[model samples]
Structure formats: structure tokens, C-alpha cells
Target: MIRRRPPAPLQDAALVAVSLIDVSAHFDAGEPLRMACAVASAFSLLLRRRLPLLTFLLTLPTVLFSDAVIASLVALFTLASLSRHRTLLAVCAMAFTLSDMTSLPSPNLDLAQTATLITLGYTAATAAAPVFLGQLVQTRRDLSLRLAEISEVRDHEQLLTAQAVLAKERAQLAREMHDVVSHQVSLIAVRAGALQVGTADADAKEAAATIRRLSVQTLDELRHMVSVLRASGGRPTELTPQPSLADLQQLVSGSGIEAKLMTDLPHDLPPTLQRAVYRTVQEALTNVRKHAPGATASLHIRHEGDAVRVTVTNTAPTRPALPLPSAHHGLVGLRQRAALLGGTITSGPTPDGGYELCLELPAEGTA
Candidate 1:
């Protein structure tokens, strides 16, 4: 809570008193009633800011009867600085000041001559000065506000630029990691395959076969990472070695949950579409683990003319759901992946209180 300093009431009182004293010195009045009226007009300066137009209206006519020129000048300044109708009020104040000066009694001069002398002399300049100063202050304030808004917009743009640069750097690092790890894992799989074929002992051959399978799975995961990183645009074809619908069996075999695979996939589907299907299933199963633990899940991949449909459904949790911190971006990432492949994805609760995720991708995929 920001506490503003209170207005200085004592200071305002002192200033009003001093202004009354200054006006009294210029007054040529001997009657107490005339002095009281002049003092009242001078003290009206206290309501200048809160009631600027009203103060000006009330004090403007008093200028003819009282020597409160200083107070009236202050009222004009306040009205010009604070009123939305400042231009009209400023014009009226100037005109009224001229009228007030002209109406003052003059013994030796004619009315026109007296009016001309006051309008052309110090009294006219004094009446115009406050309006000019008020306009100057208002202009400065408007300029300052505009500069502040421009500065805020510039700062926001700089922040967005910095975030874009950081995201690009992170994506580059991920691609580099995928390239290095996938290349090494692929090499290991090749060596393991050769060892499996050449080994004489049955146990040794089985161990080599297992190592080769795990290495291939690792390569598939790395390829998925590469696909994600390159989704922005213009990715090199050689950078991606995507997995297809063939890997769905190995994908769900070792999980604790009961899950089944059903597929009628077409041959020679585009790698991008295949990768999208694979990621959709992966993200669905991940969600099942996080949100519906001990659930039975099913993976379905079907061919429909020139497009492929993939669906994953999980039953209600057989055990109590685990308390896992979920960022819930997995489904969002799947939707983006499907969209990049010219596909659409939908997910919602099943009729039986389970969860169902569906994706449909074009066989030819999108650029």
C-alpha cells in the first residue's frame, strides 16, 4: 500500500493569508464591508484544484469590486491546467479580466481611452501570463506520459526478443544431443546385431539380441526428439529417422498396465505421419500413467483411404491414482505434432468414465 503524503493545510492557510495581505495593500477602501469582500475573494484560492472552474467562475466578477488580482490570476491558472474545457475557460477568463480592468473608475480619462491603456499595458500581460504557464505545464505532463508508455512497449518487445533467442538456443542444443546420441546408439545396434549372428553360444546370442533391441528403441526415442525439435520448419531430411506403426507392439509390451494394440495400417505411410501416430500413442499412455494409474489401455491404428486414424483408450483406474505432478503439456504437444503432420487430435473422457484420445493424420503428411 502506497501512502501519499497529506496535503499541507497549514501551508495553504499561510499562502492564502499572504495573498489577502498583498491584495489589501493595493485596496483603496476605508469601509470594513469592502475589506471583508476583498478578503473573501482572495481566500477562494483554497478550492482552486478541487473546484477549479467553479472557483474561477465565482472569483472572476469579484475582480471589478476587489483588488484580488493575484487570487483571480491563480484561479485562471488552476482552471486552465485542470479543466477539460480549458481553452474555452482560458478565453473567457482573459476576456473577463479585460472587462474588469476597463470597468474600474477613472477620473481624467474617457472610458475608451482607459480601456485601451489597460488592454495595451501591464494589466493585460498579467492576466494572460497564468493561462500560458498552465498550458506549458499541461503540455509537459502529456509528453511525459507518452514517453512512459513508449518505454513500456519497448521493454516488452525486448523481453519477447530475449525469450525467442533463448528458445532457439534450447532447440539447437536438443537437436545436437539427438544427433550425437542417435548416431552412437545406431552404431551400437549394428554391432550388437553382428555379434548376435556370429556368437556360437545360445545365451550369448540371446544377450546380444536383447542389447540390439534396446539400442534400437533408444534410437527411436532419439528420432522422436529430433522430430519435435525440427517441427518449426525447414528441417533436413537426414536429421530424422522416424519410427512407424511397426513399433507399436514393442512400445506397449513391458508396461504394468493391461493394454491391447489393434491396427489395419497401410504400407509405405509417410515417415512424418508415422512419427505423429507413434507420439500420439506415447503421450496418451504417459497421461494414463500420470492421471489414471493401474488402468487398462488400448492402442488402435487404422487405415482410412488416404489417411490414418490412431486412437488410445484407457479404462478407469483399477488402483488409486498416484499423486504425480503433471504439467499437462503432453496432450498439447501431441496436438501440435498432429497439426504439423496435417492432422487433428481430440481427447476426452470415455462414456465409461475412462479417457479416450483420437488422432487422424494424412498418409502423405504436410511440409
Candidate 2:
């Protein structure tokens, strides 16, 4: 029987130390032993990075030629444990088996027994080490990728939430501004027209008195709106009374739009749906006054089972359309209001050469 010869302890230790030193020095550009160290260092680096073929090829010759079996075993262990490719590890095991079977001097044991023992030992080490190590590394990499993706998604969600909060605050501020300014301006216009039309001193005095009364009312309303705005801070609240479908008739009548209202609204409709309908009509009337002065308008409201539909249509202006000097917030505000109630609003030129606004909102409980 052929007995395996264990490597000398000092020689085995020296080879391991040399291999480690070579790998460390590979990072240095000005090392004296750079050229000689390159051979071992390159293989060591490949093994660390789990490049199986390169590691196997570089270590194989050294293992087969050296008299020290311990050094050969160390190289094989490095290959099996570090490399990811199973085929390369198997090839290295086969090479080690061939080297041991052909080289070992056996007086009693046959060649087949030597080959079988070497194959069994090398195969066990190569299969067990590389597979376990590879799985551990892959698992770590997968976990890192998942963490990175989660962080990205969290960041995106936070950004969207911030944007939504900002938009809501802006809309609230705009609503406050419109409510305060529009009513005050209308009062001013009414009083100013009365003053312009008056002829006698007594009539002028009466007009001035009317102007004073209007101004006081405007100031009071503005104060109330500002107080409400301040009390809310930056948070969105439903504290303000939203206008409902009934308010649309008042808005149109006050605007001098010659509007006709048609409605079939259910008594049990949601406040949000009513608010969306009212805002849409109000915005459409405002647009008619600004963009098509002296034109007639019509408002149609219908509650059809699961949904509420609103349509506002206005005739084209006969005179030259004057450019509106103020900001166009009405339509945009109406759209936002509709969207908040899970509704849709559309405004554009009608096929009959007029402007039109159409809105739809889901009924209560249906949404």
C-alpha cells in the first residue's frame, strides 16, 4: 500500500507566508519583488474575486511540481473555497488526483486504489467548500440590492407626499384670495357705476353713501376670510363652508351672464360632489365674464344614478374680446377641486364656436 507523505511543518508555513506576502505586495507599484510576486498574487486576487478558471490554472502547475503535498493541499483548499465556478473546481480536483496517483510510490497498493482514494478526498473538499462560500456571497449581494431598491422607493414616496402637501396649501391660499377679492371688486364696480351715472348733488351724495356702505361690507368680509386663513395655518381642513349646487344660480345671477340652470341633483348627494359641481359652474361663469363679455351662458346639472354631471356653455363674444388683466385662477382652481373629489373637469372651445366646461363626479357611497 502507498502511504501519503505529510509535508514538513517549516516548509508548509514558509509557502503560506510567501503567498500572503506576494498578494499584499501586489497593490504596491514600487515593490522590489514585484515581478516575482506577480505570479502568485494574480492567482490570489482571482481566487478572492471568485474567478475560478484563472485561479485553477495558475495554482495547478505549482501544486503538481512541488514535493510538498501540504502546500498543494493549501492551494486546492483556496481554489475550492473561493472560486464560484463548479466546473473549474472539479477540474482542479481531477488534476490533483492524477498528480497524486501517478507520482506516489506504492509497493503494495494497486493504481486503482490510489486513484480512488485521491478522487474521493479531493472531490469532497472541492464540492463542499466552493458551493457553501459562493452561496453566502450571492446572498449578501442580493440583500444589498434589495436594500438599495427599498431606499430609493422610500425617497420617491416622500418626495411625492411633499409635493401633494404643497399643492394643497397653494390651492387653499388661492381660494381665500378669490373669495375675498372677487366679492370686494364686484361691490366696488357696482358703487362706481352708481357714482358715474348720478347727475344732481343729492344723487351724488346718495351714491357716495352707497359706496361707503359697500366698502365697509367688503372690509368686513375680507377680515373674516383673512382670519379664517390664519387660523388654519398650513394644514388642509374642511372647516370652510363649501358652496353647493344651489349656490350656482346665485353666482350666475350676480355675474350678469344671463345663465339658465337645469338640475336633477339627488337630495342625498355628497358634499364633495356638490362642491365640485358648484365650483365648476362658478369658474365657467367667471370665464364667460372675463373672456366673452356680454355673452349668454347656460348651466346644466344632472344626477344620473351613480354619477353627477355638470355642463357650462357660453356664447361667443360679439364685440372684440378684451384681454383679462388678472391671473387666470378660476378654471385651474375648478379642475383641482374636481380632482380632489375623485372627479374630472374639462374646459375648451365648443364645436359651436363657444367656450364650454364639463365636469363629472361620482355620487355619494358610489365613490
Candidate 3:
């Protein structure tokens, strides 16, 4: 950070030169000595950071002894810069005049000539210092303040750029989900509706019923995903139902994975929390469908004190394994949802040669 200080060396040198020239013109004799004393006094005032009071005291001795009119003028300027009250400057001026008058021998000259010259010298120095230094300080202060403001503006612009990039990525993910999952669910829904209208065989009717149920479940999941995207406007006034531990059986059956479910859950769970649990299970099963078709799966849901735990495991397919196209976005979304609800999820291949997913969520408000 920049700190405020007295004028730069070059500026101080220039001002000292001006002070010497103006003060020296007043003296009829000892011109060189008077000019030297004036410059010395100006240098002392400029060197001391705190209002030059000691410099003013030092200048007093020079002003008293020297016949140099310039030395007295420099002392008066130092006093004006150092003191706030005009009365103090006036008092110093009078004292310096008396000292100069006393130093001179009794001569043809009277008090009037000495007093008039002293008054003119003191007045000029006092008026000049403030006009010059006041403008300098004001300009420096304005420049410092402007630079600080510019730095803050640049920092804010960088923060805004980072936020814009994150928002663009989120929007792109939303569009892709809509295209993939929504399209698949819509096709399933249309096929089920047609089968309901035209199918007469018992097996055909049963197949249609299964398709309709899965289609509706998939539609509900899509709606929740969309709601999450839209919630960025603000907290949603109403949250869509989220699938939880209770929905594991239906999710497995609907996905055509031969599955078994074992659970020790309470009769009820908080809807918000249950949804997180359900989505974790749902995502795991969807991965199984895509990567391990014809594999058997097992889901376990257990309630421990203050938390509900879920684990889903699916065996690897017997057929030659195909490299499934990954949608890493689904896992990213699942992890985010779990974190928002104060939960955790883990997915990997199990030691027993099956894909496994484990999830845990707080049950504070859940039964």
C-alpha cells in the first residue's frame, strides 16, 4: 500500500530555490550569507515529516543573529507551514523583528524602516508556503485515491468472469440432460400409451403396464432435475418429490435389472432427505442398465442413529463387456445433491466383482 509523505526531493529542491531568491532580494547587504541561510531553513522544514516545529525553533537563532533579511524571511515561512494559528506566526514575526533591530548598532536608520521591511518579508513568506504546499498535497491525495479505486474495479471484474464461466457450464449440462433423459422417457411414455390402446394379450398388457410405470418414474426424475436448474432464480417455493430409500425396489424393477431389496427403514422419512437417497440409488441403477445389462443387482437400506445408509451392488455382465459411453455429469449432479442435503455418496467396483454405490444422509428431521 502506498503511504503519504512530504514532497519528493526534486519538488522540495525547486521550492527551496524559490524561497531563497524571494527572501534574498529584501537584504541590502550580506546577500550570499542571507541566501544560504534561507535555503538551509527551507531544507530543514522539508526534511521533517511531522509539521516542522523543531525546524522552526532552529531557524529562530539564525533569524535573530543574521543581518541577512533572507534568513528572517525563511524562518517566517517555516513558522507559517508548521503552525496552524495565525497568532503564533504573528508572535514569532514580532520577536524576529525585535531581535534584528537589537542586532544593529544605533545609526541614522529609525524603527519605521526596520518595521516596514520586516512586515513585508513576513507577509510574503507566510502567504506563499500555504498556496504552494496545499495544492501539492491535494493533487497527490487525489491521485492515490483514484489508483485504489481502479484496483478494486479490476478485482471485481475478475470475480465476475469466473462466475460467468461456471454458469455457462451449468447451462450446457442442463441442455444435454434434457436432450438425453427427457427424450428417452418421452419415447417410453408414447410406446406405453399405444400399447394400452391396441394390445389384447395378457403378457402384452403386463409389459405395457411395466413400461407405463417406468415412463412415469423417469418423467418425475426429469422434472426434479429441471426444478433444480430453475431453483437458481431463488429458493423454490415448492420442491418436487425426491426419490429415497423407499423407491429402490421400483427403480430396480423398472430399469429391467433383476434385483433384490433389503431394508430396515422407518415408516416415514422427510421428503427432502428421502429424495436425495432415492436419487443416489436411481443414478446407480441407471449406470448398471447402461453398463451391465442382464446383471443381477441388490439394494440395502439401513437406518443407523442420526443417519440413513444405502448401498447398491450389481454383478458384472457375462457377455463380452462393451465400453459404455460415460455421462460423468450424472455423478457430478448426484454428488452435488448429496452435499446440499448434508450427505455423502461413493461409487466404485466392489471386491466381489460388482459395481457398488454407498450413500449416507443425516436423518435429523427424517423418521
Among these predictions, the greatest lDDT belongs to 1
lDDT of 3 by residue, 170-277 (tens): 554464454347545654654575575568988988888788777777777775775566444222221333345556666666765578888888757877677667
Residue 173, model 3: Cα distance from true site in angstroms:
4.0
Please give the distance, in angstroms, between residue 51's alpha carbon in candidate 1 and its true position after superposition: 1.9
Name every residue pair that clashes in candidate 2.
Answer: 1-108, 1-109
Worst-scoring 10-residue span by lDDT in model 1: 231-240
Which has the better lDDT: candidate 1, or candidate 2? 1
**Which residue pairs show collisions in model 1?**
none
Please report, as a residue range, the 10-residue window in candidate 2 with the lowest summed lDDT.
100-109
Task: Write the residue-wise lDDT of candidate 1 on 1-367 in tens digits.
Answer: 9798557677557657877876768776565655676677777878876887777766665566656666677778777776557568657566656645644444233447766676546666776788778878788889999999999999999998887766666565454454345435644665576677779999999999999888767766776665666554232222355566687676677344579999987656767677677767766765675567668898888888777888899998765553333334456556766776778998899988899999988776422
Q: Which stretches of candidate 1 lie over 4 Å from their true place?
A: 1-15, 27-29, 84-87, 102-109, 114-120, 185-367
For model 1, how big is the CA root-mean-square deviation? Answer: 11.4
Candidate 2 yields a Cα-based lDDT of 0.61
